[model samples]
Target: MPVLTLNADNRKELAAAIADERWVVACLCAAWCGTCGSYRATFEELASRHPDKLFVWIDIEDHADVVGDLDVENFPTLLIQHENLVAFFGTTLPDAGVAHRLITAQTELSAAQLAAQADSSEERRDWQHDCNLRTLLGA
Candidate 1:
């Protein structure tokens, strides 16, 4: 699927995406970021390769109410989730190949492994409560 530009009009769709088994790869960025603008096409191409996943382009400045507290520290930060598990959340290098590898690795894991990671450390545990897009978007 193509990248979904998150906003009020289609939050319901985001909600359904969140509720699915498919991975939610959200690129948390800002409209003014030069790197983000250039990387948009690469992100969309990456999404096409994984049709079952839901890729969201969230301009943090525009949707601050939804992602404000997610502590996005860099442009093109990727928030990856599956079911209730926040598999990964942090700054990602702009290289689409690197993203491909990361997403593949995360998605290849079984559900038990993901749930274990969610409880493996304090930070990981916090991700379930804090950084989950489902919780943030209430979707």
Candidate 2:
């Protein structure tokens, strides 16, 4: 699947994906970031490889309402979720290989493992409430 850029028209599609419990791999970036612009193609290619997952590109400055209260500290922050659990949320290197590895590792975890890991750390537990795209987007 191609990367879905979050916008007013397609917000519901992303919302539905989250509500339906699909594994959503979202890249939160800003329009003005040069790294984000250059990395878009790489992100798209990553999407193509994982057709089972929903890939979303969220331009933070454009969708402040949807991304409210979530401070993205850097460009190309990746948010990976399955069901209601946020499997991983953090800034990643622009390298597609690194992303591929990370996605592979996270997606390989069973639901129970994911849930346990989500609660394993303060930051990760906080991600469950703070960084969920479903909650943030009001899905």
Candidate 3:
């Protein structure tokens, strides 16, 4: 499936997908970043490969309300979630293979494993509290 760009038009669909507990892979980028522009095609290709997961492209500057106060310090930051548990939230290399591997690795974890890992470290715990898209999107 193609990557869905977050906007007013499809915000409901994205919200519903998150509400349904589907695995969501979101790419957070800024419109003005050259790296983000170049990585857009790669993100799309990653989405095409992961048909089972919902892929969303979010421009932080354009959708500040949706993003809220999430500190996205780098371009192409990714937030991967299943239900309310944020499995991973951080910056990644722009390489498609790196992202592909990350998505695969995260998806392989069972729900219990994911939950355990969510609090396994201070950083991951912060992701659980601060980086939840469901909360950010008000879904």
Candidate 4:
């Protein structure tokens, strides 16, 4: 599937589509960043390759309310989630190949393993409570 750009027009569809996904990959970026502009195509390519996963292009500046309380410090930051558990959340290089591998690795984890990781450490536990897109955006 194509990348879903979350804006006022399509936000509802994106939220609904995410209901059946095993994982969600959200690229948090800003419209004005040149790096973000360049990374857009790569993100789309990744989305095409991973049709089962929901890929959301969130322009932080445009969707601040949706991103509430989350501090995205750099361009192309990725928030990977499985259900309400945030498996991974951080900045990454703007390379589809790298993201492809990361996504594959993340998807391979069993549900039990993912749950363990989400509470294995204090930081990880915080991720479970804080970084969930469902909680963050009420979707």
The residue-level lDDT of candidate 2 at 81 comes to 93
lDDT of 4 at 73: 80
Candidate 1: lDDT over CA atoms? 0.89
Q: How do the residues 49-118 of candidate 3 rate in per-residue lDDT, one tens digit apiece?
A: 9998889999998899988689898988999999999999889999999999999999999989998999
Off by over 4 Å in 1: none
Instruction: Kindly list the per-residue Cα lDDT of model 1 for residues 1-139, writing each as its tens digit.
Output: 6789998799888888788878899898898999999889989999998898999999999998887788888878998899889999889999999999999999998999999878999988888888989888877
Q: Is candidate 2 or 3 superior in TM-score? A: 2
- Candidate order by TM-score, decreasing, is 2, 1, 3, 4
**Any runs in candidate 3 off by more than 4 Å, and if so which?**
none
By TM-score, how accurate is candidate 4? 0.93
Each model's TM-score, in the order given? 0.95, 0.96, 0.95, 0.93
Candidate 2 local lDDT, residue 122: 94
* Residue pairs of candidate 3 with colliding backbone atoms: none
The alpha-carbon RMSD values of the candidates against the true structure, listed in the order shown, are 1.0, 0.9, 1.1, 1.3
User: Judged by lDDT against the true structure, how good is candidate 2?
Assistant: 0.90
Worst 10 residues of 4 by lDDT: 13-22
Cα lDDT computed for each candidate against the true fold: 0.89, 0.90, 0.91, 0.86
Which lDDT value does model 4 have at 8? Answer: 88
In model 4, which runs have C-alpha deviations exceeding 4 angstroms? none
